[model samples]
Target: MNPYFARSRNDRLAVGTFLFGTLLAVWYLMCVVLPHYQLSSDYVIYAHYATMTILYFQSLANFVMVTVARPDGNCKALQRNQQTESAHCDACGIVKPPRSHHCKVCDVCVLKRDHHCWFAGCCVGLRNHRHFVVMLTYLWLAAVYGNVLQWTFVGDQLGGHGPATWFRIVAPHVALLTGHVTAYQFFVAVMTFVGLLCLVMFSWLLQMQVVQIYHGQTQHERETAVTKYDLGWRQNVTCALGSRWYLVWISPWIPSPIPDDGYEYRTSAKTD
Candidate 1:
């Protein structure tokens, strides 16, 4: 594979910038722009609430990581020869490994059976799962933090005045005046709406993660339980995060298990 295609350092940097810009832009509007026009207090409150809600989502994502085992890289499609000791896969003409499955997206058999993630634009397989979870969870936290900062700053900027009093004071001067609300107020309302959406999505993800954790499966595994062996929660967690999580995360050179060449066919033959 081309190094560039596998999410290079520059790609990470670019994605990071986009995340920063997206979250910061939403926050800036809530903090500076909405408050300047003296928007509704409820808007700011919702933003603050949204900011704190992301912790749950991050935890949920971690749980999902454990639930979903990734596919191995040694899977191949085959025409079954029931009687043969060693069967050949016509698709790749290679033997499929034990616990391997063909990934339609990757167009190859993967070992271990983890799911693909389109949002990350990569497979959430063993090699990348840790970094993927870290990236996703951190981004979720950052989004929350930004909105929290936004609402808190907005409150500080506006002082302790009541919404009603401020609304009355700003009414005549505010643009886009409706019978019920001024332009500034409406902008804040919009910010609140966006914040609420974020909160809902995060919350739903959290709930799903918790549910899967309790059931001892990831979304993928839950769906494919009939064919796949559910490794249970403890093994799933250890395999994804590593048995020594502290060392796994800290060490830069720790090697992961690699599939032995032709073991796929050998294992399959024994099973057959």
Candidate 2:
């Protein structure tokens, strides 16, 4: 009930709305409006339209899941006299299970706490980590797809005019918003730039997540050099991504069963 926790949650909701709206707007303009306007002969725009829509909704659904799913903190059930090894959370005056850590921003201890993500406006902990990862994967795909489509549209615009014509079109728009270009053209150019930026940023984040899964480490554990839960690669992946791991990327609605209840985890003695 900390004020900051409430503020962070609100911040994440706003971010989610902005992200979803921007992506959807760009996809609509690029995949539908531009193709129809140009009387595009290529059939790929039709296919891209469907694919982009799927990716957009899938990403948005998972984003909502991650935002709403709260971490399993030190609850009353775990607080009772249990033999399981646990730590005391002074802030909440409760017993925290192994691997759980206190989130200062959330003002609560989270099970398998990774980190608080400002973008998602939630703690990336046991309950929502899979959703977070899947969301990123889909969003990254959307960005890549948008970039390709927009680039192709730019090429079509410049056809027979040569590369130099890009400046001729964009330079006038920059100064006076008057040019040989339509509004759709300006939109495509802006979306292409944004897509490239997202691609680079998300690519690095996705790679880091993959590495952490492979090594059986959370962001917090990686920082601490702790690898007690260093199960084999397959187990580690299932632990984080759930049983239906292969289908997680395809859609967010798929049921991905986490192997163990968040309270209990199988660990190895080795620390890497």
Choose the strongest candidate by lDDT. 2
Give a tens-digit lDDT track for model 1, residues 1-272.
31212144544564455445455555565456545555568867676546544443443354334324333432333323232334344555555544444555545554444455444433555555554444445545655665555564444433334685345335423423544545655555455445545656655654554444344344565565532323455544554455554443333235443222223311111111
Using all chains and alpha carbons, the TM-scores for the candidates as numbered come to 0.48, 0.79
Q: How much does candidate 2 score in TM-score?
A: 0.79
User: Which predicted model would earn the best TM-score?
Assistant: 2
For model 2, the superposed segments whose C-alpha errors exceed 4 Å read 1-6, 9-17, 24-33, 36-43, 81-85, 155-189
**For model 2, where is the 10-residue window of minimal lDDT?**
1-10
Model 1 worst lDDT window (10 residues): 263-272
Cα error, candidate 2, residue 7 (Å): 3.5
Clash count for each candidate, listed in order shown: 12, 0
In candidate 1, position 26 carries an lDDT of 54
Tens digits of lDDT, candidate 2, 216-252: 8889888888888989899999999999999988777
Name the runs in model 1 displaced over 4 angstroms.
1-103, 152-192, 206-218, 226-232, 246-272
